[model samples]
Target chain A: MAELTDTAQQRATGLLRDYGAAVRAKRIRAAMYFVALVICVLAASWSGEVDLRKFVEGLPRFGSYFRDITPTLRPATLGSDIAEWYWNFPVWLELLLETLLVAYVGTLAGATLGFFLCFFTSANISGNRTVSFVVKRALEFCRTVPDIVFALLFVFAIGLGPVPGVLAIAIHTAGALGKQFAEVIENIDLKPVEGLRSTGANWVDQIQFAVLPQVTSNFASYVLLRFEINVRGATVMGFVGAGGIGKELLGSIRQFYYSDVSAILLMIIATVVVIDLLTERLRHRLLGTAKV
Target chain B: MKPRIAEPCDIDRLRTAYPSAFAPGYARRAAALAGISAVVGLFIFGVVWLGFSPSALVQGISKLGVILKLMFPPTAGQHMLVYLQALAQTLSIALLGTMLAALVAFPLSFLAARNVVGRWLLRFLTKRVFDAIRGIDTLVWALIFINVVGLGPFAGILAVAMSDVGAFGKLFSEAIETASPKPVEGVLSTGASKIQEVRFAIVPQVLPLLLSQVLYYFESNIRSATVIGIVGAGGIGLYLSNEIGQQSWDHVSFIILMILITVAIIDAVSGRLRRSIIGAQARS
Candidate 1:
């Protein structure tokens, strides 16, 4: 090995020191992040009033509530009958069905409205810039307000029932789906639209012949997803006296009908799971067709 | 053969040969028309049943007018600080919930991840557990926690955390599973322990994604926390609902405006934050 000159050795030492400094800087940065996190956590705990001592003491109570909600028939009454476990299944089932119908109808109506508006709103597809702006603003307004809030107003306007729930869900869906649908439309292959336009097709004809074919599957998928959300929203809307399983749920909670609350919750959960499975399968089928 | 413009007869012959090029099928048209009509029919059915009569609508509009007129002077009223405190509490609930859930989910995701859990049975069971947790709504959890915690933001925080834990379990596990194994193998080749490998390889890969997701959820949880508050868990929602219940439309309007502004601001900030963080990660 060649002998290192004095200057070369000095340079090497300087480079090593610089590298160490860089490493130290990184460590300091990481430490600062940790410190910030801790500070925020402390602040959050203070503001949230989350007393750990109380939480530890209350933990058992939490478990006991769950335990209490669990249905326990007397040993003498024990049997294989499902009805014994879910005494209010028939009434709950009807309310759940109504909730489903609310979602289905709301989604259908919203999707139709959204499908029209999205084409106009898409930046790429310009019929009139002014019209698109107004539609976009309207959709933004619709979506910005939470669905439950709308349900509350509708309850005031139309009186209590699933009708308010439907109206609320539909308006909210129109806003949300319109934005997504417009994005999908904007991202589509514009060549097809251009081709239709070159064939002397009008705006409607162009969208019908070109854009619709490409976007329909995606539109359907979004609608299906919205329907799922609307189902949940419908349930919540009922809490506001808009009508559905939520009304009974609220009543049960208020009356401390612990077993009924658990039973109703279970039914809702089961319905959601089944819908999730169905939608997953349906989405796959639609996407598979889209590829072809 | 001389080139010539196609006559109408020639065009008709071509159209007959390639019908799809010209006319949509009668069946398809009919199906579309039928579908639209059915949707309209159902909407009308619901509308009619809901008593959306023209006169009823006019009457309702007049009633709404009265509320609107009252709501015009959007003042914070006497309890501005109370409203502000409630808003702060809501933000804290969302922040703490998101952070706590992220902390809990980070470890449990390994159990749920198909790539990490060697046994199919363990992974399947873990996923189902996650699913069950997620199947329960945040409001439902809030109600449960309300009875246990005896109201206030503590219950709201727990409710948000519980729901997010379920969501983050699925999301984090998916993130873990999608990570390229090459870096992990490289770490293993260096005679590193399992924990070291995870730290050197997996953590580096997924931490950015985890952070980004937590940030995104923080924004959404703010809104969700408000909803939970409506159930008396505690927040601006409780305040807003009370105002509405008491027919204090001005305060309700003010609170609503605050919510809208807060949400919009958070959305914009999160977008920027994500872009910067992801960009930094990409460069590194």
Candidate 2:
């Protein structure tokens, strides 16, 4: 009994020593990371030209910029003041509509393309390994180049219009959605697929009957999410002179038309918020009833 | 379980009794058809409204091919050093912006979390604020910052930081809310203050997740930081746009390649880091 107690104490001491060493090692690792973080922060500040004095001085200007963007309104002429502030309302509205259309068309086209590509890309569906590998890399290239950069290229290629905007958004969307759709396809129950195969169903038929039903709702949800992102992307497409209210917004900002800038900004924010809410509802509805 | 049909007569009776289930009701089929038609109709309308023509697409593709041909034999020309500097600045902007955003978001996220903030109204308002900030594009923020602070990478950093704050706040708050409550209760049972309880329990649980998210954003922000310069916010983008303006295809391709390589490298590194950190937390 005495020997047993002695061994127990020895083991306890050994365990505590090991724990202490581990704790010390963890502390050292944490300290090193902290030091690295500090170094990076300082280096970033230096390279980014983050001057404290400039920032402090700019603070008041920042407040003023916001203040300046706010239209002066009295209780008496609030309605007219609002109207006057949004003087280019008709033009901006038309552009906003165009932007929405661009996003819509882009999403539809992209989702359609992704729908086809995902079958080819999905590991369980695609039998051709080389084809899948090549297509996967192609999709990566499409998405890796940011949509705006694509817009810039398209604008150069196709001449400036909403068409380039649509194409850019579509390509990026296809790349992004294809990857997601492939993931969804990869995760579907394979039993249905196996059963279809046993019945001598062709590859295309199997995909259509077994795979499409399982992934459609998920694909729709993802497409809607892409639409939301594309809308935001479309807003900035005009920055590259592709088309939309962004060009107007940029022009106003550059020419220092503060109120117009604010007006357009407000319209954009409102549109995004409304779209976000609508899509959130749609996504919930789709996902909530997905079991069906 | 239903009673097994032992005869053809019973099958006939079941089919008559559950005709709608056996063949989906007309209304349900009609609804599905209508939904598909509506989607198709919308696509057609959008195509027409956007003036999307197959011929135009073909023309554009050919034009793009010509331009892509010009992009071959990618070269930096005389501006390699300048381009390198700009790239570094973009990296700096992304890093600093992510750090600042993380700092601002870390505490504010607590106020937005349902479990941390008792008041529903406050939490709702906080979330809305995050949404509003996030709704605005990063470029718009860059434009605003440029106007206020004048043009430079500073504006780019501010823009990235501003946009990321909203994103980080939302994600961090969600992370905090999802944290297991057992640790919180254990800490509370020790008669610890609320702050102490949070410090000892919640932070440790969510920190790994939050850090991983922050790292992921940092990787993407590098890409954004590259673009903000097109609007005079400062970075490689200004040079890129300038090169494009001059139709310097070789330089354009070189710069694009650089951006791609940088993005790929960051993605890999951040992915490894996130996995390691999360893995460590899981083990602990």
DockQ for every model, please.
Answer: 0.50, 0.75
lDDT of 1 by residue, B184-268 (tens): 9999999998788788989889988888998999988988887788888888888877888888889988998888888888889
- Where is the poorest 10-residue window by lDDT in model 1 chain A? A75-84
Clashing pairs in 1: none
DockQ score for model 1: 0.50
Query: RMSD to the native, candidate 1?
Result: 3.7
> Mind sharing the TM-score for model 1?
0.89
Off by over 4 Å in 2: A1-19, B1-18, B53-55
For model 1 chain B, the run of ten residues with the poorest summed lDDT = B48-57
Give TM-scores for every candidate, taking all chains together and pairing residue i with residue i: 0.89, 0.94
Off by over 4 Å in 1: A3-23, A73-81, B1-62
lDDT score of residue A217 within candidate 1: 92
User: What shift in Å separates residue A180 of candidate 1 from its native position after superposition?
Assistant: 0.8
Give the distance in Å from residue B216's predicted Cα in candidate 2 to where it truly belongs: 1.1
How much is the lDDT of residue B227 in candidate 2?
A: 91
